[model samples]
Target chain A: MFSQAKHSSGSGKTREIKEWVRKFASVPEDFAILVTELKCTEPGCPPLETIVALLGSENRKYQQKVHLSIEQIGEIDAKKISEQLQRQLENKEESVERHNEH
Target chain B: MSTSNNKVPVTVLTGFLGSGKTTLLNRILTENHGKRIAVIENEFGEIGIDNALVVSAEEEIFEMNNGCICCTVRGDLIRILGNLMKRRDKFDYILVETTGLADPAPVAQTFFVDDEIQDALELDGIVTLVDTKHVLMHLDSSSECKEQVAFADVILLNKTDLVSEAEIDQLEIRIRSMNAMAKIYRTKDAAIDMESILNIKGFDLEHALAVKPTFLQPDYPFEWAGVFEIDNSHLKITLSEGPDPSMSVSLLNIGEASAEDVTALLDQAVKTFSDKNISLSPGGSIDSTGKLYKLELAQTGSKTFYVKPKKAGKYVLFTQHKPEEFSMTIERNEIEIDAIFSTNYEASHTHDSEVSSVGITSPGDLDEKKFNEWLSKLLREQGTDIFRMKGVLSLAGKSERFVFQGVHMLFDGRPDKPWADEERSNQIVFIGRNLNRKMLVEGFQSCLKKNRQLSIR
Candidate 1:
């Protein structure tokens, strides 16, 4: 099971970890293995073991989340998922700009 | 050197476009026996050859982590070879299918350049497919085609079912003129004896050299000329081997007009080849397809050209260019040279074969002066046929293995550390045409304490 988690207080280390994940995810089938390797190298990234456990946990929210497919997980159709992520990031940038103006 | 008690041979399958290379590749993969095979298909596209169609099980080593492995040409070929070596335990033999318009030289060069690839996989043989119907045309207009034939250890003249006897004969003659060494087979629908394709090792240098006509012979110097006109592209023409070097230079100077004219000539040749339904290659892009004409200039002013065709048969220039215009002097001794070129002026020596090892021993009983004389004569005579030599030889009772190598006229010597297996016998591999094996055997043997025979069978 794969999921995308958004977190604030992102440092250079966190951004670097994300970029590594993106690069690893570019390859087919080996994405999960590469992601797991990256998590070990990542300074403060979430442990892949924790993610796998969470996906199997007995909580209603976790169970419902398990039902959702990882559209962003390097399936060739991830292009659509990337477009949605792009829109969200753009909106967040606009709001930050407005907050700084105020 | 293919398999040392279990090492599988890696065979490279190469040819021009639509030459039935892939068809032969599929037959080998699907029909072969118990050997666990790995297929490396270098295409202009990303997709691999169809698994169900080419091989039943693509599971062993299909996933190459390198982005360039499955696509492009030599760059991808090296990566694929590297990846295959890493996973060598999975397969018994590796078969690489080069792109239709690919040249075998670069791919063959990969085995020698990368030490890791070289150690893991020995270049077993280069199997080139020539489409019978279009081979002549391809040879006439495609430079890549000429290089392919020149580098082949074995040539599969496939699709012979489609052509007439006369056409095939003309094609064989052209192929031989370009590559005197390659074993040509007239196949029907790409069908070939898989065993014959796989087991082929180094070339029979003596055989190749013998087949090459002597352009150095006196009294054959004659002038001949033909104007090749083209509208759009370059004309790929080949001079048969044994061209007297002086005449070749003069002919090249005449043919060497402006780059635009060369392109126009090629375009017209390709147009004609297409009109005749002969194939022209580096096939896809107009810009990518460049024809290289192979010419042999014997020292006697006699010349021959080898044209790799796209559709028509190969062309040979039998006489000199007796110009209707002004004249140029043709000198003799200047004919002994080998040169290759493109419009960008990157013509250097196109052939890259080298004798990577040598063995030498000076007998205790033989007189030093007499031995030196015999060895010197042998070196000179054998040297004429030697392209690149690099190997170590045992010197009689000495513990050291003498290292020696030469490329064309250049030779060098050094001392190498003694091998653990002294019983392995001192051996040397020579890579060139017309090398006299019996003469070399006798010369080296005469210096031996018990007459050691050096036959590279």
Candidate 2:
């Protein structure tokens, strides 16, 4: 249910990420299932970046949703992650090209 | 806890072949002068102990049971020890001599595991014998050589009469770097005063003073040459370095081959070490000191062979065990490179600090950031002389304490625990490795009593 604009806040994003990172570090065991069984429910969910980050924090804990960059998502091996990121990047490129056309 | 009376001391005698182990044993039994001692010998073959010294033979735990305290403690080293302890009036000390190939950890484990034996016996020392002449050769070819030396408390450099003076000095120096605790003794005919050799407790002996066989100067300066070659498609890589500072190198070959392929090659190699003819050293007589040895791994699948001789001498990593798959040579002050493609693992992360926890407090007003930078540098420097680094640090204004553990540059994970007391200072211990002990102490002291709220990040 999270929006991309809301997740893209400057300092707000930093605080959100820090709070999540601390939570993830404190209760790492909760993140294990999400990392191992990652899937996209909506047609457009953030790419595999969240899964990779979760895998990297196997030593920590997590309690909230995670947003990730394209490069981070590309590093993941999940088919769902790859497909979602490919579609998202393509859509972004199409919008930029449309703006150029106008 | 039950306190038992009269704890018997168990002394372990170990070394590679021709290192004069049996000679030392004979001397101990026949010449600890008049000390009533019980001897336990573990042999690799069926030939048994030299027929000349069997005093009284009985039921052995393994195969051979000759007279002179020779019984295989197969399932029963403890049972035998207990039986001997029952007759304690007959002996003053117990010396268990393991096969040159046998690992002393198991024998040492025996004393720690058994309840009755644990109460009755104390581990005195592990005395390792080294054939001064052949030790370099063993170190060059065998992987087990360094592990043998690593566990030694008293190193007897036997056969001093055979090797040249230069070789003897080189051998002594090589042993020192591997083990700083073992007292080095130079002997021919394996002769030493029985009293001084036996009943000596040898744990926690500092290795700095033992012997500097390789890197004589305190600086421990040396260069390494890595060479990789392919013969008929099998890969072989060799790394050469100094005999001083008793360095041991580990070589790992990551390849795309299958584990089954590597396992087959390793089996062949193990059989080669056990073979009587093609194998230069006797089975189990292999000792690695200040020489070059090789281990090979033809990667099968993703995982590969991870065998490195325990010692830091010369080593070559190969994919096959055949002679054509390997060849090596060594000399003083020069590392020979005769193979072909190799490169160093480029360090991805460099440590940030040159100083350590020993000095955190100085009038210079040093801070947390500076301390962390120095600690990181010590980790990145390959030649940093470190034995063990451990401590608890307080984040500038944070009440929680961060725990640190380090060995060379291999330290990570600074997990924090709640501070127990109001003490604002941190405590860390660094043992061995070339470190400025006084400067380290001062660096740690400077971190104490800081009023500023500094972020640990």
Candidate 3:
């Protein structure tokens, strides 16, 4: 693992986070996972955040964010964020099923 | 690769069913008004044209593995354009009439994806026809309707005679808000000057929308700015409940300042809005110490707030919502004081629009290094959300205006015609989804050589 002091913006941290997202989300290695750093100056928006977009096998796009900057994120942070995204994905699946049943 | 001269221009006609696509197609085909046109239409039976020029379009869409997320291209369009190339002298132009329900992206993507098609054919522009009378119903319900309008380079709001002028104006605002860069031509029965619509070179890196002052007043960061010359004594700004439950106001002191000073203050107020606003109870005091103040209204009846200037000769009060909405009045020493200088600013951001246009036409040369950094960062993160952006910019130290346009993140720009006798100014229009005009203006302002970058920290 690269130095945590080496901001998450570095390629090493991005790759590690991508792996954690795939592992937590239960996706294959070839799955599309993108890590982006966004700085939104607008109020209520964190000064710096990490946006992750993961494409599911079924093609449903899942997007989530860690409030901290990439370098600031740890393995625990990534795991928690990924699990939250996974839960979101499951909730959406349940909602879609509910709609189809009706 | 064939030069632009030989490239057969293809214009995509898209709209909901019965929005006068056939009318416009037949008019262009039969008018004998000049250039030989070959049409690739899926709905062949809709038009009565029984000629060599009319070819049936095969609706075959293939998912592209080119890594451009979900990029789908029409297989039939590639085959058709290839066949048309063999019979070189048959036609100079290609018009593809897309089905009302079809997503226009695939058809557009074909030109960009296919190497041979890109060489021989130019994706001229997409023209969407809007059924003005019934569009509001579809606009609220249909994603297809929204996509068609959002993807257009030009729009024709057809059947205008059926709707009132006020209704047309609202529809125009709705459509214009969706695609700011697209030139909207109001029409009845799809009646349009064929010369004006055809061969416009709209998608060409060089060709762009004429920099007319845009009709995007509602999307301004703030709705109103009332300038007043007040003393250190307490002054009252009373408002009888207006539009929204809450209102945001930024009172900035501009003491004995010039027009340029007020302009700088206006930029300051735009950034002030994004800072944590001090939510005040109805009768809370408003300090003119440069900060955003939000006042809660309605339940407490008429909201009367006091403005205690730090030491004010002249102060500009920027309201998120219009002062006119809340019959607002300012009084000093129980005597009303008329604004020595007053101007209304539109600083309200767009609400209820997934796709909106932001037009910035400001005078001044922009610092090149600053502009490059701001724009590169903007396009890098926001390219997927941004559909099309085009502009003519006045770059610092450049005599000529820089002309540029981009699809998604692919931007192309160059030094164009010099600003000879005319005044040097920058005018740009962005047609995209969830575009923040305040951010765009602030970013652009920060790049300018004249004004200090006061909008962003």
Candidate 4:
């Protein structure tokens, strides 16, 4: 049973994902990026999820999650996540600028 | 308006453990001053026993527990102070006694930063009591002790009976050296005159100006400070080895003089550096009358500023901003020469971990829009680390003086009384952790009116 049990272990993949996210997100050097592999207990929630959170000024957080384990995430998934985060950041900047204008 | 809108003076009493702070509090409460006072005791332990000792006194006593007043209990203080304001009719004065290890900056800043607190109460003064017998050991071991001494407007040397007269004199000298503006009083068992401690108006700019002409000058921390000789020839000043990326560099020429007399002139110039009366030139231009000039780079993070003196004479370079590591050298004829001078005034000693106070006094009207934008962004980013900020400013196109101050992110400012017959100037002090004095000074200089001619040379 122990030999058959499946575990999420992908240090190399995780490192690659983080590097790709950092390069595409263009987050400030001071801003921190936190990646976590969380398991959901709720019946309707995804069984396993990978959350990538970018924390920056004014306690702002940008999070993108994939409903899959770290081991399952590949370059294509990382690219998609980075694009989503970049769009979110651009939207945030636009909203902030508009707010300042008003 | 809230009933607390009426300005009730709040006095912060800070001291080390076994420093007779309680005795002084008790005396203030029991003394027949004919004024009702409220006491807020910030106790350290789980149990609140100090209030029990003061239960017999007629003054209203409020206890704040959980942690030191300077840190975790600051919110508790704000809440209690707000509550006390509701019962303002019962008391005419508010006294806050901080725990032994508390830094008084936050406590004093509470009044300035909070809108409700600012309207309800005025910071009368920070009165720090020092135990004559054991304060030296505490001062050497604890940074809190030094900060308490530094932030004090009035320091009472209590327990004088325990120490000899010679020791008391030595202690007073040391305290004065750290904070020259504070009024020092000798007492035994915290027995001080009620008039000396209460309603002192130490924070009142108008009253303080009346007492000491240069009351707004801030004490800075730096390893070395000196005056250097710079002739009409082009000189390349390189700060390649300083700890910080930049340093506050002021160049002032008090006419033709020898290198031997430069130290004495520099001493006089340092006094004028923080003097609120003397006007400063805009954009670091040479002041024609005072003969003082501040050097600043056009861009940030650039350490070198090529100096071509207008006239051949002696110029003083005073470097006392934050840079704990490395040294400075001046390049003459492509040769790196160690900048040499005479006077070596050792600033107040503190570890790199401690918060330091940096004061900048300029004698030019500030552009209001630029100043507000810069200050707001600064507070938003680093307000938590910056414990206290106070400034009396002279804004362009405004006859009234602008007096503003803050604690953490909360800042308050308003047009104070008219300039009257006094000279218009700006004096600002920032007490915080890891403060970049050079950046702050440069940023403030950038806020001056664009037309350099407006500045009085």
Second chain TM-score, each model = 0.45, 0.43, 0.75, 0.59
Q: Return whichever of 3 and 4 wins on DockQ.
A: 3
Model 2 scores a TM of: 0.37
Q: After superposing candidate 4, which stretches have Cα over 4 Å from the reference? A: A1-102, B1-6, B42-89, B103-119, B161-181, B203-355, B420-423, B450-457
C-alpha RMSD of each candidate structure in angstroms: 22.8, 27.4, 14.0, 19.9
Give the per-residue lDDT digits (tens) of candidate 4, residues B118-170. 55578888899999999989877887898888777789999999999988977
Model 1 chain B weakest 10-residue run by lDDT: B62-71
Please tell me which predicted candidate would have the highest lDDT against the true structure: 3
User: Tens-digit lDDT track for model 4 on A1-102?
Assistant: 111111223245555677888887777654544454544333454545565655554444566767766667776777777777777687763121100000
lDDT of 1 by residue, A1-102 (tens): 001111111133322333443443332221111011111112242222211000101110010001112222333223332233334333432110100010
* lDDT score of residue A78 within candidate 3: 76
Which regions of candidate 2 are displaced past 4 Å? A1-102, B1-5, B44-75, B204-217, B220-457
* lDDT comparing candidate 2 with the true structure: 0.42
Better of 1 and 3 by lDDT: 3
Best model per TM-score: 3
- In terms of lDDT, the poorest run of 10 residues in model 3 chain B is B62-71
Residue pairs that clash (backbone atoms under 3 angstroms), model 3: A7-A71, A8-A70, A8-A71, B220-B347, B220-B348, B221-B347, B221-B348, B222-B347, B222-B348
Residues forming the 10-long window of minimal summed lDDT in candidate 2 chain B: B63-72
Per residue, candidate 3 scores C-alpha lDDT tens digits across B182-292 of: 778999989998866777677665576553425554544787666777776778988887778888888888765456667667657767988898988877998756788
The superposed Cα distance between candidate 1 and the true structure at residue A49, in angstroms, equals: 47
Candidates in descending TM-score order? 3, 4, 1, 2
Task: Name the docking class for model 4.
Answer: incorrect
- For model 2, give the interface RMSD: 27.2
